[model samples]
Every structure is written in C-alpha cells, then in structure tokens.
Target: MTTLLEGKAIRKIFKTGTVETEVLKGIDFQILEGEFIIILGQSGSGKTTLLNILGGMTQATEGELHYQGQPLHKASDAELTLYRRKEVGFIFQHYNLMPNLTAYENVKLAADIAEHPLEVEKVLTDVGLEDLKDHFPSQLSGGQQQRIAIARAIVKNPALLLCDEPTGALDIQTGIQVLMALKQLNQNYHMTILIITHNSEIAKMADRVLFLKDGIIDHITVNEHPLAPEELTW
Candidate 1:
C-alpha cells in the first residue's frame, strides 16, 4: 500500500506563561492509502492532539509531517488552510449540522465550499440517508444526524477523513450504524480514514490499531482480518 501521510518525531506542547504541559512526545507513524486506522487511547492520552495535527487543525511543536510528499510541518497557515480545504475532511463527536437546515442542505453547504465535491444527493444516498435528507436535524435521531454529518464530510471528495470520537454520542446500536456507514465509505470510496477513540470494540474494525499511552504509541496492531462494525460487542 502507498503511504498517504507520514509523521516523524512529532511533538506538541501547551504553555501557559511559565507552565508547560507536553501532550505528544516524539510520535512517529505512517498512514497508508485506503486504510481504516484507529488511534486508541484513554482521555488525556494525546489521541485528539495527534489527530488535530494530522488534520492540519494545528501544527506540531517539533518534528516533521508529510502528506503525499508535501511538507505539512513546514507549511504556512495559508498552505495549511489549502491543504485542509482540498485534502482533508473532519468529523467530530458532536454533529455540527445547522439546526435550521435539512440533511441535504447541511451536506450541500459543505460541498459548496469544496474545490471538487461529490454530488450531494449521491453522498446522502451512500450513507443511507436519501429518504431523510429532507428532514431537519431536530427531526432525526442521533444516529441519523450523525450519518448526515458523515455525508457532509464525504461530500467534499476529500482524500483523507479524520474523525474524533465519531460514535461517542450514540447508543451501542446507533454507534454500530455509524460505523457501518464509515466502513462502507472506506470500501466504496477508498478514502483513507483515521479515527481516534477510546472504544476497544471499535478498534476491532480497524485495519491497523495504534495503541497510544502517555503521549506515545504504546504499540501497533494490524488485524489480518478485520471484523465488520456489526460484529463488534459494546
């Protein structure tokens, strides 16, 4: 598999005056194209920090990052903005959809901003939300709302999708539905996906699992045969 992104000796620190709190300490990893990667860690384990850096929401305090040979670490704010706009899509734990907009409209809003976007209706159908696309966010269930958020992210036709605790807000069954949608996206669109979560069951569905502990990757596990999302136990 080809390398989609690479990080070497990456570190991040948050400083408040004289106080310094180090989050990521010399992390290194490579993400492959079309792979479903899970970064598993407990809270305060720097999983979100690492994801933020990888997604271009923030820069590393030290070391290097390259995306398809582009020097992300050296990229200026303008360059990073372009990189994020053109190459990456993000999904958070909270579905950040506009309450006033219908599912289709919410997704179309993202597609409008993207340089090369997929058809909004097609992306909605891909996530099994075609029937509910006309419904407002408040009219949908949590899982349906999340699927809308997933549709919004994928509509950008992004090469990489970064999700931070995507299913954390749902019940076990609902979480399974969201995971199934993500798995389908991984298989059908061949989008490289990186999800950071503490759920061990969720890790079973990943092609590769990066176990993070205390600001460093504790170990890396590659699943020879990954389970489908529905096969996971809550």
Candidate 2:
C-alpha cells in the first residue's frame, strides 16, 4: 500500500500564436509500489504527456510530482538523469534500439549507464532472447527487436518501468509473447510497471487501469486478479 508515484493537481499547458492550450487540467493520481497500472486513452488524450511528466522526461506546467517521496521538480538535471537512469526504465512503441549496434550491444549500452545493472545474459534469457544476442536490428523481426527493448529495460532492474504503446508495432500473437515476458517480470520481480496504450484489451492485464479523455481522467478501475495476456479481450 505504499505510494511509488504521485501526481497532485497536475497541469500542463502550451501556447500557440496567442492561443493557449491546457493539456492536463488539475489531474491527480497515485500509483502504488509493485503495481502494474495501465493508462488507456484515445489519440491526443494526454496519456503520453502525463507519462512523460511522471518519468521526468518532461516537466508539468503546474502541480507537483513525487517519485518515491522525493520531489521531481526540485531535482537537478544531473539528479534527474541519475533518477531516470537508476530508478526508472523506459520502453517506447518504436523499438529505440541503436540500428548500428547488435541486440546484445544495444542492451549493454543501457546497462552500462545504470548505477546497478542486471547481468546482461540473465536479462536476455529472461526475455527469451539469449540466442538473438548478436543479431543487428535490421536482421531481427519487429517482435524480436521489441524483446530486445524489454531486455534493455529489465537489465536496469529499475524501481519503476514506463512503457508507451509497447506492443503497438507488433502483431497480436507477437504482442502477447512480449506481454507475457513483461507480466512474468512484474510477478517475479515486483517492479512497478506503468503502461500507456490505446488498446482497451490491454487493460485486462493490469492491476489497475486509468482511463483518460480530453486532458482529464475519465475513470479508474481496479482488478483484484488481472487476467493473463492470453485472456485479454478488446
């Protein structure tokens, strides 16, 4: 029941040609430790923006953000870099792997920057990618590349993992495989995982789901026993 991430009265704004746009309007929420919370929303719903703020990737125009009880806004850039490197892991829809580097090399690049990196081989095996280690991105399928991305994130053994449309680029079967790998990690490692996606089917796999619409949270749902990836429905 301990809070791992919290955003209080969060607000974000942008101005364009004398016009002001408010993206998040006084939204507030909290994520508990070891929880897999999925944020579901349609296009332009501010889900990604909210997540960016949570991960220190971007600052909120207003309000407060605390990660493990420390003020995010007060942290220096170096502190935030360390905060992100050691405490948080990120996965994007587009496999953010270095095309020039082999799968093994790309994962190690991230692990090298971490304060405490998990053994590269252990993480690769966990994601079922040990055999694909030396393959380059161009030599791998979309799914394989994504598995590499997951391995990269898990290699950090971070306190919080942020995934944005993790399976957006994969076919259903491949996406499920990826989710299974991620779900297994959540169950075994007890890492706090936050996934942002447009697919409502994906919410069934989360301990809690936050639904957003037009810069506001429309609803929040909690499932005591989340379904496995194979059991999810749209």
Candidate 3:
C-alpha cells in the first residue's frame, strides 16, 4: 500500500537573537493508510515539533513532507492550508474549543468552513457528546470538552488525524474514554491517526510505536496485534 504520510530528513531550528536552538535534528518516517502511530518521547524531546511539521502547522527548517503522495514542502502556504483543512485533522492538548460557543455551534462553525463537512449529528454521536452539544465549554468537564474537540476534528472526515497529548488534562478513566473514542474513529473510519505523547502506556493501543528523541527516530516498533484501547493497561 502507498504511504499516506511521509517525512524525510526533517529538521527544525529556533533562533532567538544570537541563540540557536535545535529541536529536531533529522526525522525520517512513513505512515501507511489506516495505521495508528504513537510517538513516545520525553518532555522537550521534539515530538511535538515533528508533529507540527507533519501537520504543516509549522515549517521545517530543512527537509520535506508528503501527504497522500503530494509534496508538502513544495506546496504553497495557501495550498497547505487547504490541504490541512480538507485532508488533515488536528487535536491539540488544550482542547482549543471556543469558550463562548456551545459544543454543537463550535462544530457547526468549523463544518461551515470545510469544503466537505461531516454530518454534525454523526460526529456528536461518535464522540458521545450528543446531549452536551448544547453546553458551553465552561459548562462541561475537561473530558467532555475534549470529546467535542475530537468530534470537530473528525467531523470533516480528514484522511489523517493528528493528536498531541489529547488526554493530557483528563484523569485516567476519562483519558481512556477519550482514547476509546479515538480508537473507534481509527478502526471504523480507517483514519490514519498519529499521536504524540509522553505516556508510554498509550503506546500499546497503537499499531506501531515510534520512539523519538531530539527530533530523531530512536526506534520504531510495529505491533503485529495491537491491544484495544479499553484493554490497554495504562
């Protein structure tokens, strides 16, 4: 099968007035369609930097990226924006939900912008937030809010889903619930999902685990039979 995501020799460096900080030295990896990939690393290990590059949310100082066989580096910013909008879904750690808007309205607003919006009801149902849709971010719990965020991301039915510490703010029980929802999306929708996390426990739920350090892939392991999210002993 053709690769759905590819990153070649990606490097990102931040310069702050005579100070140069190297985040990712060189990253090279490929993810096939329908694969669940978890990136495990320590804090400040460049995991999120690599994810940003792959998602086109940030530019790589050096190297290239390919999504669905299309060149990301060569694509213009506008083109990349469109690509991200229609082909990639991003779930951030902070939930990124609008505090003022109700859960349902927030999703509906995003759907209005996408070229092909997913069924609002279906996404709400998928995330188990049908009833909470009428609630505002301030009115819901962290886990419930995050579920709405996940619903918004998958609502467009993007080919790829990128999650960064998606369960960071929640407790164990709620975290598992979020992971279960994500796992269901990956399995049922066949969405190629890549998650960046410091939690090694979450690795078991993925089809493959990529251990990253200093922005380089230290090791990659493919699990012949990954455990179900509910079965994961986190």
Candidate 4:
C-alpha cells in the first residue's frame, strides 16, 4: 500500500504568556492508503491536536508533514485550504448539519465544493441513510443525523477521512450503527480513515491502533483480525 500521509518529528506547542505547553512531543508516523487507524488517548493527550495537524486544519510548530511526498509542513494557508477542500474530509462529534436543509441538501453542499465528488444519493445510500435523505436534521434521530454527516463527508470523495470522537455523543446501539457506517466506507469504498477517541473498546475495530500518552505515542498495535462494528461492546 502507498503511504498517503507522513509526519516526521512533529511537535506542537501552545504559548500562554510565560507558560509554554508542549502538546505533541516530536511525534512521527505514516498512514497508508485505505487503512483504518484509531488513535487512542485520554483527555489532554493531544489526540485532536495531532488530527488537526494531519488534516491541514492546523500547522505543526516543528518537523515535517507530507502527503504523497508533497510538503505540508511549510504549505501556505491558501495551499492548505486547497488541500483540505480537495484531499481531506473531516467529521467532528457534532453533526453540524444545517437544520433548515434536508439531509440530501446537506450532503449536496459538500459534493458541490468537492473537486471529485461522488453522487450525493449514492453516498447517502452507502451510509444507510437513503430513506432519510429527504428528512431534515430535526426530523431524524441522532444516529440518523450522524449518518447524514458521514454521507456529507464521503460524498466529497476525499482521499483521507479524519474523524474526531465520532461516537462521543451516541449511545451504545447508535454508536455501533455509526461505526458500521464508517467501517463500510473503509472496507467497501476503500477510504483511508483516521479516528481519534478516548474509548479503548473502539480500538478493536481498527486495522491498526496508535496509543497516545502524554503527547507521544506510547506504543502501536496491529489487529490481525479486527472485529466488526457490531462485535464491539461498551
């Protein structure tokens, strides 16, 4: 598999007056195409910070970042904006769907901006929300709304999909459904996915797991046979 993204000696520091807090301590890693990776960490472990840097939402204070060998660490703000629009998809815990728009419209908005977009209806079907595409966000359940958000992200045909605590606000059953949708995107659509969460149980479904501790990777593990989303409990 090709290396889709790479970070070498990455570091991030936040300065608040005389207090300088180092969030990422010279981290380094490579993400391969079509791989489902879970970044496991507790609160204040810098998981979101790393995901932001990887997705071009933020730049690292030090070290190098590359996507398919193109430099990202030194990319201009405009360049990063283009990179984000063309190559990356982001999903946060909140659905962030426009309440006034129907599910189809919400997903369509993303497809419209994408350089290589998938069919909006097809993407909705892929996420198992085709029947609810005409429903508004307020009309749907939390799980259904999240499915719409997933559809919106996937319709862009992004090469890299970054998710942050996607199931953080969901119940067990609902979270399982959301994970199934994400797993389908990774296995069937072959989308490269990276998810950051504090939930250790979620790690069982990942192809590889990176354990983050105190702003650094404490260890990494590969799941020889990852479980299905439904197999996950807790």
List lDDT for all candidates, in order. 0.95, 0.90, 0.89, 0.94
lDDT of 4 by residue, 1-234 (tens): 999999999999999999999999999899999999999999999999999999999999999999999999989999999999999989989999999999999999999988889999899889898888889999999999988999888899999999999999999999999999999999887899999999999999999999999999999999999999999878
Q: Which residues of candidate 2, in runs, are more than 4 Å off?
A: none
Write down the RMSD of candidate 3 (Cα, Å). Answer: 1.3
Per-model TM-score on C-alpha atoms: 0.99, 0.96, 0.95, 0.99
C-alpha lDDT of residue 129 in model 4: 85
- Supply the global lDDT for candidate 2: 0.90
lDDT of 2 by residue, 92-187 (tens): 999978999999999999889777889999899888989989999999999899999999988978989899999998999999998998998888
- Against the true structure, candidate 2 reaches a TM-score of 0.96
Misplaced by over 4 Å in model 4 are: none
Residue 146, candidate 3: C-alpha displacement in angstroms: 0.5
Tell me the tens digit of each residue's lDDT in model 1 across 64-167: 99999889999999999999999999999999899999999999999999989999999999999999988999999999999999999999999999999999
State which candidate, 1 or 3, has the greater TM-score.
1
Worst 10 residues of 1 by lDDT: 225-234
Instruction: Summarize candidate 3's per-residue lDDT along 52-98 as a digit string, tens digits.
Output: 88888888888888887788988888987888888889999898888
Stretch of 10 with least lDDT, candidate 2: 73-82
TM-score of 1: 0.99
